[model samples]
Target: MEKIAPVRLSVLGHPQRLAVFRLLMRRFPDRIPATELAQALNVKPNTLSNYVSALMQVGLLTQERIGTSLRYGIDMQSARETFDYLLLDCCRGRPELCAPTSNFDLNNKASKKYNVLFLCTGNSARSIFAEAILRQEAGDRFNAYSAGTTPRAGLNPFALEVLQQKGHDISVLRAKNVSEFQAESAPQFDFVFTVCNQAANEDCPAWAGQPVSAHWGMPDPVKAEGTDAQKSLAFQQTYGALRNRIRVFASLPLGSLDRISLQSTLDDIGQLENGVSA
Candidate 1:
């Protein structure tokens, strides 16, 4: 732990390297393509390659080829170990110092209600599932909204089916254009999340409120292939994935968390691999 922790810290010591790591953390579980990562960091491809290599050498990042381009994602196992080392070994019995502190001024009205917006490319499946799940699970605590970058003609039938099976009211669910929420008349969002890779990568509309944003990208169940039962199973899995995430989000002590800590928690939530884990 001692050796690995210091090495990880040294690699992240460089400003550009740290920025790269932070961006990956915010987009956890969604591997960003090489070109997109470079553009997002405003770093040259060659330089970014070296930075990525440094992180990979220390086991802080993982790389894979999705088609023709290389994609990068955080190595969650390494990250957890590094964090555990810091909290367990460095705290010297003063664990309170490591705990997240409250910043009441950031979200002072968390005790009341929070408006959350979930986004995706089609708004027909993943985003719809997220909206419905949060509404059903935490309706009193959060107002759930969803929209698409380029909405489809209607909601995905399988999504509606799964929601109906789960006893959710599907009457209010529809594929909405993101512009609807960007309008001056829309409610001020406290949290904005992109639930699919396409929406997360796209240039999104500017929200009126300075909402905390994160990428919680998941596989699109709508694109599932095979028999009808298989396709329906995909939708059910998507619903389960969103439900697990929403439940964890709803259970957070929002009233006590600072903005930074809240952001971290949201990012960690994104690291959930599927419908499993906290």
Candidate 2:
């Protein structure tokens, strides 16, 4: 094997590169586009390009071509190897002195269950997809719900079709107004996420528990002007985006992060451009 330890360490030595690597690691399995990364880091394009190229060249980052965009993610195995190298022989033959990676699980049952609410202009496509995906992925750790400023008469047919086709239960899904959740007896949300630009920018009723909020704006698949197949593709893309975002959200150490840090992290996730196209 090549002696990549030095190369990996060198790649991570720069502050900007390290920050980029850490950000990618936060999204782990999800690939983040260059534009999102640039925005998150608040760095110029050339600077980010250099940092990204260095990380990829050293196997610390991996990039995949999705349509016309290049999405980047951390090389998890390589990252683990780097950690292993850093900790090697540091415990004086005492395993307890070193942190055990085997016991770490993001989906541990002992973690606190958070109630999450997703909102949009209409309880039709994006919000519904987010609710279903979050419930399916981390239902044990999160109570996922969806509402809209103005709900449609019924759930979007395309949304239902996509959820069902992906093996998600849609029987319990319904299009409901945001006012329903604002009632006195409604569940107090721990986090409220707006999934559409319209809902994000509009005035919303005060949620119980004073939930932390973020805007994950996505293009409305319902507004997609194309053939049935193209519209289906749009819905599928939205599903992928929401699923990826939820996965990252579910993996967060909610109990460990304080309100400010958690809020910042949530906002960063919202900035991701995973499935914005439609």
Candidate 1 TM-score over all chains jointly: 0.69
Q: Can you write out model 1's per-residue Cα lDDT over 1-278, one digit (the tens) per residue?
A: 78889999999999999888877876776788999888877789999999999999999999999789999999999998988888888886466889555332445764577889999999999999999999999999899999999999999988888989999999999899999998889988888999987677554555664687888878889889999999999999888888998898989988788777998888888888785674
Residues 1-278 of candidate 2 have per-residue lDDT tens digits of 13788788887889989888877754544577888788778899788999999998988888988898878987888887877776664454565678543432223424467778999988988999999999999998789999999899999899999999999999989998998888889876788888875575454555654677777778899998789999999999999998888888888988788777887788788777883322
TM-score of each: 0.69, 0.60
**Candidate with the greatest lDDT versus the true structure:** 1
The per-model lDDT (C-alpha) reads 0.86, 0.81
Worst 10 residues of 1 by lDDT: 99-108
